[model samples]
Target: MVPISRLTVIAATVVLIDQWSKQYIQGHMLPGMSIPVLDGIFHITYVLNPGAAFGILENQRMLFIAIALVMLGLTAYFLKHIPEPFRLMRLGLSLLAGGAIGNVIDRVQTGHVVDFFDFRIWPVFNVADIAIVTGVGCVIYTLVFSTFPTGNQENQR
Candidate 1:
């Protein structure tokens, strides 16, 4: 189906971009090195995260791997249920799956996820993190606005 194709394409694209960006960063920057892209605002800082977001549960590589696998499975299951017209949902699911797989690969191979894109305020993150967060935001927006029959509208219907 078109939806499945679209989902696959999106997922593959995200994975490719995420992996490539991480590879580039690893190859160019030394760990703990920081290169300012926009002084006082943005920078690329190399960091190897041994845990989940914000570096929580550090060194729990196995746990993160298990969680990523579970997330990928759930994303696939969720995609199967999303209707064709709900393109945003498909995109969201794809991003989520791709991001999960990206990080999983790092965790499996290196026992750490490569992170950059330092903003100084928030914890440093990478392409996979961006995709995952953006995907979740899209899904949440779709659920809140498109899927739900809002109370007033429901009453009218």
Candidate 2:
């Protein structure tokens, strides 16, 4: 079983990073402000998203709220079923939960998500997106790379 204490630590870190980044952008960056950080390759642009990724279902605050709640619930349920040996995966999942909640809190409070990290080739996003993406990537990596060797491999070892 994963240690509850460790999971709490990971969750707290994710929440802090996500919330702090959003707050920093909201407070310091003017709405619609775009500052090119690396010529035409990277920029920091402030934006508020009222829906899901890429601003889907725009202005459907209630739908976003329900979706976030369902996601958080499903994640919590699956956390216990994840492989016991996959601590990294567990931590990653915890971060996902925390990050989702962080953004959900923002949406509930302001009816939008604060996004500011703008990539040249992609839609603008925030720290919560980074956490969620990284978390999912870790789970995928664990599934693909950490599977137990079978039959002949185990016998040979």
Best by TM-score: 1
Report clash pairs, candidate 1. Answer: none
- How does model 1 fare in lDDT? 0.88
TM-score of each: 0.90, 0.86
Tens-digit per-residue lDDT, 120-143, candidate 2? 788888888888888888878887
Q: How close is candidate 2 to the true structure, as a TM-score?
A: 0.86
lDDT score, candidate 2: 0.84
Clashing pairs in 2: none
Give the whole-model CA lDDT for all candidates, comma-separated: 0.88, 0.84
Highest lDDT against the true fold, candidate: 1
User: Candidate 1 versus the native: TM-score?
Assistant: 0.90
Q: Cα lDDT for residue 155, model 1?
A: 78
Give one digit per residue, the lDDT tens place, for model 1 in 1-157.
3457778888888889989999999999899999999998999999999888888999999998988898888888888887776777778888888888889999999999999999999999999898899899889878888954347876795
Segments in model 2 whose C-alpha atoms lie over 4 Å from true places? 148-157
